[model samples]
Target chain A: MNKPASLVVLDLAILIDMYGDDSADTICPALSRFRSEASKYINQLQHAVVQQDHAEIARLTHSLKSMAGLIGACQLMEWSQLVEQAAKQRDQTMLANHLPELTTIWAALQTELASSLLLYGSADA
Target chain B: MTLTRNIHVLVVDDVILMCDFLYGVVNKVAGCRAIKALDGKAAAEYLGNERIDLLITDIEMKAPSGLELAQRVRSGMFSQTPYDIPIIIFSGNAYREVIEQSIAFDVNDFLVKPITSAGLTAKIQYHLQHKKVLKPMSHYAQLVADVDYAKAIELPTEDRAFSVAIVRELPEPKADDVDQREAASKAKEKKEKKEFLVWPEHATTGYFQLDRRMRNFAFNVSCFHNVFVENCKPVAIESERKRACEAADYLFHISKNIKQKDNRRDFWLLFQQRLDKLQPHVKELNSINIKHHSQVLVLLKRLAYWWMQTCSRPLIQINEVTHETADE
Candidate 1:
């Protein structure tokens, strides 16, 4: 089995290399912010989609995309980009279709990243 | 005065979460204290009373906006102290006009939001240590012009946008002409797509000077890839190990370069995170003495594609030309 072929969950090694023993100290707050902020935006996004508020949806997802990308949530970032573009273009159908997937992806990301953060925190401690 | 004691950062954002995030990020740096302002008016009020070493404000805030805050500080309208205060406009919008306006207002840097802690800290520290004296907007304009001009000069007249004349009349339609036009259109479309794959303008750090310093980095990655291919050594052999060692050297060189540029340390750190993801694959490829190392090659190729996509093909192509010209 090629170990290289698997998707990387978190590049904790790089973070540790960068921040040294302070890796968790730096990343934990950012990830914590991501958790709270992402949840708020996802709720806003869903409401915006229901109201067909394309501009508001675009604005909300744009921040979500940046935050997701910052935390190395690749799939979430990619999905946010699509939703942002669709919202910008006022494509209701596309936004409706992808919003659910984005929600699902965020759930998976939360679980995966929580464990990743724990690993870093424990290592640092 | 000690660096940390003197350094005061004002973090302005309409969203309380973002303000908290920036405050958290700033306090991480040694000798830095971050004060949060919820909107433009609050930030303006802070400027009136307190001495802020660095100002990081979001651009899209309502009523007296970040732009307004920047203008007020520059003009010394709010404060008694009259000097250039390092202000960084961190916003989600990369609208060209807004950027131009921000630069005109003498905003030190325009960092796109959703910025990592590292990227944000780098700009903050850089601006805090070395306050900008030059007109940032002009530097940005010239940077864009220089990039465009360099692209034009290096391309053939047929390929240059300046040489493309507007034709009002179509020659009498013919089958051969139709096929030729269609082929040209297809080729043009492909080129346009490639051109669009550049570093986002909104994410520009207001420092074009770093590009010159980083030129070597762009070359080193390319050179490592080329050397590996040219040698044509078997993957399981000693030569393969040598190549892995050489790749590691390039990685180390980049790490050192990032370290030396203290102001840009966080920015480079963000990029390093992405590079780190590719490292394990390289390590795996190096350790395994076997055939079917195609995955490693593919990963390297993908990394190269991402580098080009991020740094931009035009800049890389121009660097290649300069290198070739120098070699000659």
Candidate 2:
């Protein structure tokens, strides 16, 4: 897997760290939200990969890569690019090892995001 | 007057991310609400239903570029159609072609992009203030002896905001030739009408001295404001250097007289009351000035902390600017 550029797809890592969710606790909710969104896209990406749809995989991975940068998701930020590179080269071995770990981090991020959203939802409402 | 309450801002950009960023920033401004459009075509569709007070559209886009949108907007051929709307083209390029296009399309203004939140807000404030001045010129029709030129500037068909160009009072000659031999009344109108003559803000900085050379009083004040921005501070002026300096020099003389008589209290009182508000040069710069030392300002802490936080980052760095430009 080729190492991806830090900010090609998901930019604004700087801005999110600076400004996203100024009202939330540490702006981690934004980070969590990014993780959940990536999970949904990556889930679709897995389906595309199994069906040999490289184009869809590229598009989904590219978007998730960008989103990772936006939310400053460190591991996914690194891994999403590798996923994109593996998909590009049709390296199923590299893609398979990274997908489960990416999915796991993404799941943990969703639970955290949902909990944070619930907390803010009541507080803001 | 403008519906000085919430002026609806329509932010058009091709990038979804940029559009969302502007919407957040605009919504935070007092007396403003924002809607987003992903591209110029999306903007045209949104305009059909929305009565937007201002349009902040980006220049580069996938379809119906911002300039094309501005042209269609000026022509009144688009769908929530109003008579004339204020538009600011947000481009990375604010060069000759973009500026001339804005002028030909009758855009209220132009701003260069990659601007920070503060820079973006400044242009917004300027156009909005320009609209305010013109919109109320109607009620001052009494000043026009009730020959309402209100329609000349225009009232937005839906809301009452006036177009910025009409709001900016043009300095046309009062039917008098530039001769010392002009009739008494004609000469008097010239004295009162001096400031309207001005170098367009887009003019090259080189042409600035020409206004001073001509001794055009109102144009001089405009020049003074621009000069301060260019030179970085107020300059010491010579007595009777040019006709433009006449009104200001006379005031300076009066101020000197007050100083010689030990009237510091009265002089500063007059300064706050009658001077800077009317003077082209204003001392109160940047609701967000970082170079000065003051405790009352918000956002200073954030700026102060940026250096400490970003010191370890590989690609970014922050530093304080020692010199400051004057507010134009």
Candidate 3:
């Protein structure tokens, strides 16, 4: 009578029938591509900070904010907003404080991204 | 493997994040597709055209609410009967009585929000696997009729494999007249035996010998005795076939969390060990008509393999775990 929780998540097996393989193939790549692009954008933000390119940092963080939101990155989206604000004010102190939080966020993202991608691969395969 | 390939899954919640989080994980599983609904109204709409295999629903929706939806479905006014899909309630709520009552309403599983993939996948597979084994049990059950189910017992020494066959006598034909039909049906019910048998690994023979002295594999049928038992009944919980296959893979896991034997025992020792272990539970697991026969069947079958694989003995035989007749 009692069952585990995972069954709730896997009840989504109908897509393969309705959309065919192309729609089916999109799930894993989309998740992997999302995480990969996010990582690359974060890398650019790190480079912009090193070069003291404030404009590029602000621009990159803005897009990163949306991408993080779209991907369900909880805290990463929250703190990236602050990083974006610091860039607008040209405040070195705020930007410096955000680096440690950004690093923490990025590490957590990596951990979850790895797991998510791995799951998608198995499901898609 | 794709037992539920076309099964419709409904994901419901007030929060978009939770919905997407649930959808993202479930959408990847093969043989399943998900429908997204931000609220009760959205969910009800999806239920109109599509048939959902399972429901992963958050309880506290704004307008109609999850409880309200459950009540609506339970009413005869709307029919979800054709699919007979199971519903799982998801919530952060801590009301135990409310949840228990929901079980009275026949909700399949309860999952808290912020679900883990392991927990979620395990639960889904459990129900799915339970369902898979029940197919044979049900199909065979429909064919059974009342008869003296305790087939004649065979006690042979371990030297040569004893041929112990269970002759499941078919039920007598139904009588024509109304009075005869009523009487015959009643008589049929009284004599019916457990109409189902699941062979582990689909073994050609239920028992094989470890020693020549005594019958190493003694099978104690529910309807009869003087046979042997080896282990607990198979997991009778409903499940998808693919899920049971995956769960079977965990027999090798060293974790003590699972109860089945995954270790080895001596050849001679297996006889007495199996007798002592299996003799007592035959009657209990045979109480298949108990609550959940399918789950008990699965548990018993898996237990047979568990003992076979784990024991120093190479084979295990189990019979009469269930008694339903087809001859009525």
Kindly report which residue stretches of model 3 are placed more than 4 angstroms away from their true locations once superposed. A1-125, B80-83, B131-328
The lDDT for every candidate, in the order shown, is 0.56, 0.48, 0.45
Which rank order by lDDT, best down to worst?
1, 2, 3
- Cα deviation of A48 in candidate 3 (Å)? 38
- When 1 and 2 are scored with lDDT, the better candidate is 1
lDDT, candidate 2, at A122: 31
Number of the predicted model whose lDDT against the real structure is largest: 1
Q: Give a tens-digit lDDT track for model 2, residues A1-125.
A: 11222112222334343344345553444544454556678779879877977656755665564455444443454566556545655668977877776556665545545665566563321
Clashes of 2: 6
What TM-score, computed on C-alpha atoms, does each candidate reach? 0.56, 0.36, 0.32
Q: Which ten residues in a row have the lowest lDDT in candidate 3 chain B?
A: B206-215
lDDT score for candidate 3 against the true structure: 0.45
lDDT for residue B181 in candidate 2, whole number 0-100: 33
lDDT tens per residue, model 1, B1-328? 2364657888998766667767877888778988899888888888888887778888766667776677667666655434377888866534433555565566788765446667677777777777677554445345434655334323121122211100001122353777897987687555433431222321222233333323334444444445455555554344545555455556546555544655433244334544554466556645644444564455444444334323321111111111111100
The clash tally of candidate 3 reads: 59
**Stretches of candidate 2 above 4 Å error?**
A1-125, B1-3, B93-96, B132-328
Listed models, DockQ each:
0.13, 0.02, 0.01
